[model samples]
Target: MKRLISTLMIFAFALALFGECALVFEKYTTDTRIKPITREMIAAQIRIEEKLSEQTTVNTGEPHKSTPSRQDNGAWMLTLVNDKNPLPDAYKPILKSLSNGLQFDRRAIEQLNSMLSDARAQGLSPVVCSA
Candidate 1:
């Protein structure tokens, strides 16, 4: 009976402590005016901005020069390679190995490096699993 009473006393103490903590938390949250922005929310915003940028052309001061489309430069980069669209047996790309031993297409290595560096500059750790 004594052990039962002690356990009950401990549980009651813990319950009271928890109630105090909850009250403190409620007061702190209610007093705050700022809302938290999550990484997922920021990523969603980045995706929306990317879509909008793709549809609009930037105003560079120089006259517009017609450059060949990406397809004309490197059609292989645009190839759809998934379960539904498998690559042909004869298809072979000129690959280059990165410093960390990951391989990507030689044609896009410069652009990929630039993108990775840019992302790093903006405080994002990007991991490229595949090209």
Candidate 2:
């Protein structure tokens, strides 16, 4: 009977602590006064940002053409791959495996190694989990 009572007491204490933590989390993480944003508001913000970016862009008086085979410098790093700007179906990146068994693009392997070396020099145990 005593054991059961003590177990019940512990369970009740844990439940109360969880509830208190949830309440505290909600109190600090949420603001109820702000109105929900509409799609029009987001679209307007995007337009404003686009206008700002266009104003800041400097044109070098040459039409920009995408080059595929040039991997000399970090020029290839500007290639953007996303859902809207998907890579060519036949496109394949030259991958180089690191010492820790993770593979990354060969073009940026030097930069990646330099970053890892810098991290290690700063006494950080930086392990590349994925490439």
TM-score for all predictions? 0.39, 0.44
What are the lDDT figures for the candidates, one per model? 0.84, 0.87
Q: How do the residues 53-128 of candidate 1 rate in per-residue lDDT, one tens digit apiece?
A: 9779687889865443334455666865665556656878899998688999899999999999999999999999
Which tens-of-lDDT digit does each residue in 1-131 have in candidate 2?
A: 99999999999999999999999999867978876899999999999999999999989999766544434475767766665566778988999999988899998899999999999999998989989
The TM-score that candidate 1 achieves is: 0.39
RMSD of 1: 14.7
Model 2: residues >4 Å from true position, as ranges? 1-74
* The 10-residue segment with the lowest total lDDT in model 2: 65-74
List the lowest-lDDT window of 10 residues for candidate 1: 65-74
Enumerate residue pairs that collide in model 1: none
